[model samples]
Target: MRKILNTAHIYMIIGVVSGLYSRELTKAEDFTGDTQLDVVHTHVLALGMLFFLIVLVLEKQFTLTSSALFGWFFWIYNIGLAVTVGMMTLHGTLTVLGHSSGEAIAMVAGLGHILLTAGLILLFVTLGKRLQPAPAPGSDAAPDPDPAAPLPAPAP
Candidate 1:
């Protein structure tokens, strides 16, 4: 899981950086006004995802609860990244296709991005709930007795 999350983090960072650089070039060439904003949004979303990855990696407690929470958060972050990229692609496609009928496609894509962001936030909260340390075995609050505890004396 750690390996998967780290790989995802690296890929997301690379994608964001590339997108931003491309946007800068496009702006220099006087590309559409919305392109720049889309690039910026992608970068911001990537940063948020990276933060969650960091938290997952650094967290000390590894258990079923933590695993489930991490899985949920990981899903959200990936989904958000997907939505962000999808929106940018949709915007570009609409521009290229020369569709000016309702702008509904762009609006729907934007809505998807918003939903993804909300999901990521919810995941963060759920992760908090799972961050607690597991209780020690044998007692909820007390440490287990040493296995080397002296055996009872034999009856006379």
Candidate 2:
């Protein structure tokens, strides 16, 4: 949960910095038309910062990191975001300078999007599994739903 919170914090910083950078870059280049830089700010904020903040809350409520998928989701999602945003920054900078890029750049960005999708699917699956009710004691019908989860503390 701490890691999740820290991730959100880092992303928030990055997002805000990117937005400021975009504004400064555009002003410096005197480019008025829309570019990917404008969108990258929102993408990093919503998908990276906001998303992780939500995840941090979910982790607090559900102990999401207990699941293996959580780790995978973290790494894959970060990698995807880095790729997508990196490409956006690169492509947007080039556009500001009146340069065009080949199709390969766009294709790589598409691949990053695909990874994002996969990471989202993994998160949903992890949450679904975590939300399943633990089987009743001494009932063999379903066995234990999540063996790795610690037993709840006894009530006072």
Candidate 3:
């Protein structure tokens, strides 16, 4: 879970940096200049920061890392996000510098999206399995944080 939280913080920082970069990109003309970097911040924030936050919440609800696929899901999702963001940054920078990156960039970006989708599916499947009937309110079952749960458990 610590890894998840740390990753989320990193994502937030990157998102903020991206936003600053985008703003600076347009500052040359009083915010009138268009920038390909316009969506970088949102993408990083939503996919990186927000996504992990939701996972953290889910982690509290379920023992995600106890499942075998959790590791796969985590690594795959990060790789996909990194690939997608890297492609975006590369393409955007090239465009801003007046260079045509050609069709490869689009193809690579599409591949990244495909990986991202696969990772999300893995995550949802893992989450869905844990969504079984909840304990009745005020039952003997301890409400989450499951005092007994291991500290190293990862997020959903």
Candidate 4:
């Protein structure tokens, strides 16, 4: 859980930095048309920062790390995101400098998207495996609370 929280925090910082980078880079280049950098900011914020925050909450509820596939999901998803973001930055920089990005960039970006897709598939598999029925009450397994249950009365 701590690790998940830490990952979320790191992504938030990276997302903010990416947004600032997009703004400053576009301003520096004076290129007003659509650029991949613009999308990079939102992608990092939504897919990296916000996604990890959701995962952190899921970790608290489901102990995601206990799943064998969780480690793979973590590493693969991060690598995919990094590759995608890096290529977007590169392609955008070239565009800002009035250079055309070639087929190679598109191919590599496609690979990054493929990895992201595979990672998401792995995450879903892990989550499915973790969705076992709750352990019986008082059997030493962690309690799975009913969200609709009434809150306990405060101690006197």
Pairwise lDDT winner, candidates 2 and 3:
2
- Report model 3's TM-score to 2 decimal places: 0.79
**Candidate 2 ranges beyond 4 A from true positions:** 134-156
What is the per-residue lDDT of model 4 for residues 1-156, given as tens digits with 9 covering 90 to 100? 888778878878888888888899889888898889888878888888899999888887778889999999999998898889889988988998899999999888888998899889989998888887878877899866776699999999
Looking at model 1, report the run of 10 residues with the lowest lDDT sum.
Answer: 58-67
User: Which digits, one per residue and each the tens of the lDDT, describe model 2 over residues 1-156?
Assistant: 889888888888999999999999999999999899999989999999999999987887788999999989898888889899999988998898899977989999998998898899989988987886767889878654465688899999
Off by over 4 Å in 4: 133-156
Better of 1 and 3 by TM-score: 3
As a whole number from 0 to 100, the lDDT of residue 110 in candidate 3 is 85
Best prediction by lDDT: 2
Score each candidate by Cα lDDT. Answer: 0.58, 0.89, 0.84, 0.87
Candidate 2 lDDT at 103 equals: 96
State the displacement of the C-alpha of residue 22, model 2, in Å, after optimal TM-score superposition: 0.8
lDDT of 3 at 116: 93
Assess candidate 2 and give its lDDT.
0.89
Instruction: Give model 2's clash tally.
Output: 0
